[model samples]
Target: MNSLFPILAIVRKDISVWLRQPTSIAATVLPAIAFMVILYFGAQAVGRNPVALVVQDSGPHAQELINILSDSGAFKVTMITIAPQKAEDALRQVKVAAVITIPSNFDAAYNAKKPDPVTIHINNLNLDFTNDLRRSLPAAITKFYADQSAINGNNSPIQIRVKETDLRSQDIDLLRFELVPNLVLLLTTAGIVNAGLATAREWEDSTIKELLLAPISKATIITGKLLSGWITTLLIAAVVLVVGAASGYLRPAGTIYWISTLVIVLLIALASAGLGVAIGAASHRFQRVTAIGIPLSIDLFFLSGGITVAAFLPTWLQTIAHFVPTFYGTHALQMAIFYSSNEGLILDLSVLGATAILAGVLGVLSLRKSMLA
Candidate 1:
């Protein structure tokens, strides 16, 4: 027990020294803010947006759907009385998201209680808008008839507005939602630069020999090195949290949401740091560790749905996501942000804890072998 004391001292000292470097905080924060808040919105306007709307059939059912879409605040819907050929130019130039073309038989089919053959000419690039239109249009058709029956003698149809409360704020911005997990994954890998390089750097600087000569067990030496990595990562993550708050990624609306995000990030960082040290110890060659560490971390990102949503994914994909640390990391972040989701926080922490334990044990073993050899 006394032997463990010296190693803990060294770990504390290393963290203290690293924090004294003024630029340490900057390295962790700027990327997360820039990628999440800046770059994404900068180029968003260049993507295809809405302007033109075409209606071949002037029926209450079709127009009611358009009104619902117009109210969404997502698009600026303009009435286009022009030919489809004229609308094609704007769609091609990406000025319009889609042409809401109504079939001449639209009202006839509705009155006859048959399926309408309305065609919506959409540019494949605007999948988000296209999907929204797809769902809204069908719903509007159902609502139109429901309302018409509600009225006494008028042929006019009424539209139904389903008030979907975005309990998680995910609906507000899909782009922003996608950006957070990548930031988490990137931060996790960034930890490797700080954590993986710690022991290797001490050896190159000729400090490890002095550390080993001190009154400490080999386990203490490993403990100190791992703690140094973990603490530095925590500091970096702290800066990241502040930056996320300042940049509006972490909002007051989801207090519990943000808390979960923080817990998940810390847990993943702990697991990630252990994995980083394992790379350093097993390879023994510092350059090789740096070379291999990033790619392996990236694999976790891909497996975790870092670039996409895990919800629509196949069940097999969901199964695969569990083994990756970022799977729990990103999923938990999303739940906190959008749904105020807190159901599985404990389970996520457990998975992350298991990862940290396994990776940490492996890391300690590798460090001991490398140091003693």
Candidate 2:
């Protein structure tokens, strides 16, 4: 009971100091929020490209094809017109990605069973947009043929059919998929920054000597500091989770999945807090600690597959990611909340648990050395 008093006092002192410094709190939270905002805008720019449509033919067949293109979900028809010149101008001015022009003789060619090609004036600015435009036209044409076949009681010339089977019950959008890594980043930043700041404060204010002279063991001091950071990170993470759930981004299916997600988050926070303490002890300066801790957290986030899936990265990058603790943390959370599956959960938890123990040991050793120095 006597030992617990000192630990609790240390924890309370650190928390009070953290609350008094608003700038420190902002430094801990803003970078992760900024990353999320920037990624959200990037996601918007990648989906549904804008294009122009020019219909020179007034026939039903031409109109049907236009309707098919509009409904394909690949292109946003920003400009629709009868004049080909206008669409060409829009394409030239960069108002649209491509100009699709239905030739005036399209209906005649179709009726006569002759070849008719729709001219597409594409900007070809980049392969991503160009490839999507390239693939979408063919898909639209295929759908048009199928629709015609159904209406005319005739076989469509294109025999290919694609049936998609999803492995999971729900589809996670790019923004929501990105939120997983962002959440991990937030936890990491909170843990490292808060704990690092707390330790560095003692050194910066020349209070380390006083702290060392107190009638408390080094182990208690380390435990108190780590626990303070861990509690702060949990509070921040809870806020983020609540916002995500309220906004309909993170939806854990069952109580078991929620429990698993919380466990992973707790492990990540504890590991990060331990690392933060070590950094703070070694640096012993507020500016230096922030310099190291913030960048280190950001770098870990990228190495842990920041916005992209680790599996889709280059072979060497994926191999490197496997060694990053945040990689397992992100994967564990994603599996728990998004897929609601226990696949690879045990391995992830084992890695996190090992990392937490190793970090705690390092933190204790570093703090002990710093105190003696």
Candidate 3:
């Protein structure tokens, strides 16, 4: 009861001070909105990528394939009537993201009921473009082949049916769906920077001596700071959720989803607040803390695979990502918001739990030493 009183008092006082500073609230909320807007618009602008259509087969079936590619609206099909060697040259010169070739015997194979192969030569320079080609080209082919098969009376020997079972049945916009996990990561960053700065600010203002003279253990003081930071982050997260829902970037799933999200957010807040405390205690100056904290937050977020897909990264980078807490934090948020199931939820929560424990203990120890010195 003795230590608890001071901890609660500190938390309340800190929250009161934080609310009075309007810039702090704006600093936390504005960046999250900006990132969501940038990502949403960037995804929209990536459509209609340029692709080379090298037609060697002058058959009706070949023309049908060409028409399908052009009509899909996924690509800007540049019809290239050059030889295969020149087609390769165009790819090397970066004229297009990929080249789909129709062989000379395309109609002959179709007429004889034999297998016909459409060649796709892609520039592997951009993974995002490559992924687009890999997915869209096959979908176009599937649509065309299905239409052709229906016209031919369904006498085919083998029929493959592709069924996609989506985990989320809600009619949420894809851009909005993709933005949720990213928003979680951004909230974590805000939590860390502001919390870390709060501690550093105390040192810069020479207020540590007052805390040292107080009749309270350093652990209780650190606990107060951590709780204050975590509470502030949750408040910021509420703002983020409200803004995202209002902007149509997020939809409330249900009680379970909100519960799970709140849990993950709490864990992330604890871990990030701990890290911020540690960094602040180590730096002891607001300027040094910001210099180190901002870059550190960006690096951790990148490693977390919040903004970019991690599978396309180098093997070494992926390996490094497994050790970071945000990776699991982002993963947990995705599972809660999009999956609506507890698949791998235990493992994700466990990693974050352990991280919070370790970081919080280390932060307390660091602050203890600083105050005693």
Candidate 3 residue lDDT tens string, 295-335: 87778778877556665678999999988888888777777
Pairs in steric clash, model 2? none
Candidate 2 Cα errors over 4 Å, as ranges? 26-46
Per-residue lDDT tens digits of candidate 1, residues 1-373? Answer: 7856786787777777666766765665566656755645753642234656666777776676556556644455654754878787877877777776766677778779797775667676656666765665565556555566566555545544457775454553556666667766666776675677766666667677787787668887887777777877777677667766776665524666767777777777777777777777666556876787778777777777766677677899988877676777777676676567676878778887787888788888878877787
Q: TM-score-based ranking, best first?
A: 2, 3, 1
* lDDT agreement with native, every candidate: 0.69, 0.86, 0.78
Relative to the true structure, candidate 2 has a C-alpha RMSD (angstroms) of 2.2
TM-score of each: 0.74, 0.92, 0.75
Instruction: Tell me each candidate's RMSD, in Å, in order.
Output: 4.9, 2.2, 4.9
Error of 2 at 96 (Å): 2.3
Between candidates 2 and 3, which one is better according to TM-score?
2
| Model 2 TM-score (2 dp) | 0.92
Q: Per lDDT, what order, best first?
A: 2, 3, 1
lDDT (C-alpha) at residue 347 in model 3: 95
Estimate, for each residue in 4-108, the C-alpha lDDT of model 2 and write its tens digit: 999999989988887788886676566555655675676676657888999999999999999998987888888889988888888888999999889999999
